[model samples]
Target: MGTWLRRVLLGGLLITQGAVQAAEVTFDDIQPILQARCVMCHAGEAAPLGLRLTRLDELLKGSKGRPVVNAGDPAGSELVRRLKGISQPRMPMTGPPFLSDAEIALFEDWIAGGLKAGRNPPDTPVAPAPLQRPAAGQPVTYAHVAPIFASRCVKCHSAYGLMGSAPEGLLLNSYAAILDRHERVRVVPGAAGASELVRRIRGQSQPQMPYDGPPFLSDEEIQLIVDWIDQGARDTNGQPAPSPVGARVRLQGVLGEGWTLDSLPLVVGPGTRIDKAPEVGDYVEVRGRWGQDGRVLVERIRRR
Candidate 1:
């Protein structure tokens, strides 16, 4: 009887230990939450405050000055404080729809259990699924290419991307924007080999794009983009290319405030004419088109 009771007690203890181990949060558990909620404002070079949440090393390294996460002490961690709003500017910096309570609790639990970085998480989000290539012989147009960009590139390349500033001032929002640049050409009609877009994705260029990778562009997706560029990278209508729009816009803040026109991101090109230096809240008329990278490339501007 004594031996049987001891055996039963041991079995109960083993089960309890397994339960405790299962309950402890690791980086893997909270990674999806970070990718979905945090990395948008905390990846790459344009990351605000130099805080990068994309990798465990970056998270552990914290922002420019101090650590964001404090292991074994959720109350003392800046990341936890920011999420809880005990710190200034409740995080995501672009929110009212902040991280859910359950999500925040996960971080709290992870930290309290001793922050373990765990293994790396998958690079892309789970939803919307991976894109399949369009049927063969279908004219590869913006339609075919947009999904590829939306899925892989736009997170870091769009105007509103978390990188704060899109790399190389590029914005991949529309075809007109994509083709209107004066800087190094991203795409050359009928020549995929010459297109920087193709080279980067194919890993021929320095710093192969989609910046986060190992799971790079699938061959079918790469072929689609190459085919589109080879086919002149046209809009769906294939009509004469649209010209940049001209507008009279008010400046909300100083040029140093980062250029904007009517709340849309703007870029001042060398060709842009400024009759007078505009100050914050000043009104000006400008002619420009959306660059391929999705910013308004100002060609001409004058006080209105």
Candidate 2:
């Protein structure tokens, strides 16, 4: 039905079915698909950020009164970013179960081509960008923690966020801002247990964060922040910036390759607490922190 062939499917722009490539895509091609896949939480008035997917116009109207689409630029579009998860909180809200490559392509091509009702050949080129992942056992740093803030916190902690810009003059929108030595400092690096940020999210303090949900930062997400702080609140370069010690992490995995846990070397010290005498080939749990030398300095270990 389209003038183009579908071969390379990626992130919803179904230009790839086998190898996935773009087709003569149009809004009509995917309207029904969105109706089926996205109209759930995104259809009615109570939708988050006022974003609705019942029609092309509504989708184009965007969320928070900002445009989610970017005419022919899928990378610049927030909708595509969320679909591919380049942005925070991947969508459909009920997914993994997410849109198929073909389904996603229809939307991708529609956006990258014309993002309109009528069929049209692609006028703009679309290709997947390379993705980056951290190296194994990488110590948590501002780089890891920053995106989480941007995704979950900044909406309320910004000038555009609270009543008059960054409540109590505390901002979580950037690296330096979060580390601001202001009177209302939120992060106290290396010591998440003592940090105001951690206390609030863990609900040990008043008014849990995201200030918006029962759907708070996931355990994995909170752990990431905790790890960042515990590892001494390192910067993007894995270097600490004069902070306190973070709470210990609970790591469970099989012991392998001589004093290695999950392929990482463990530093046993006079201070390390051990129980049941763990050995190689035994399953165990370790509670520890990243040492300055880039290895786990075991605080406690036990056979599980």
Considering every candidate listed, which one attains the maximal TM-score? 1
Q: Give one clash count per candidate, in the order shown.
A: 6, 26
lDDT of model 1 at position 47: 65
Tens-place lDDT per residue, model 1, 210-287, is 897868988888998887777767665543233223322222222324665445466886777777777556655545
RMSD of 2: 15.3
Model 1: what TM-score? 0.45
What is candidate 2's lDDT per residue for 1-304, written digit by digit as tens? Answer: 3434333324346424534334567776876666554654464555568887766667778998689989889888898888877876665443444567777776778888767665433322121111123579777767666656655676566655535566767677566677665453456665565456786777654467778767898887788888887777777777887742333344555677767765757788899898998888887877776455545668899998
TM-scores, all candidates, are 0.45, 0.44
Model number with the top lDDT: 1
lDDT of 1: 0.67
- Residue pairs clashing in model 1 are 170-293, 171-293, 171-294, 177-291, 177-292, 178-292
The weakest ten consecutive residues by lDDT in model 2 span 123-132
| Runs off by more than 4 Å, candidate 2 | 1-59, 63-113, 116-135, 162-164, 244-304
Give all candidates' CA lDDT scores: 0.67, 0.66
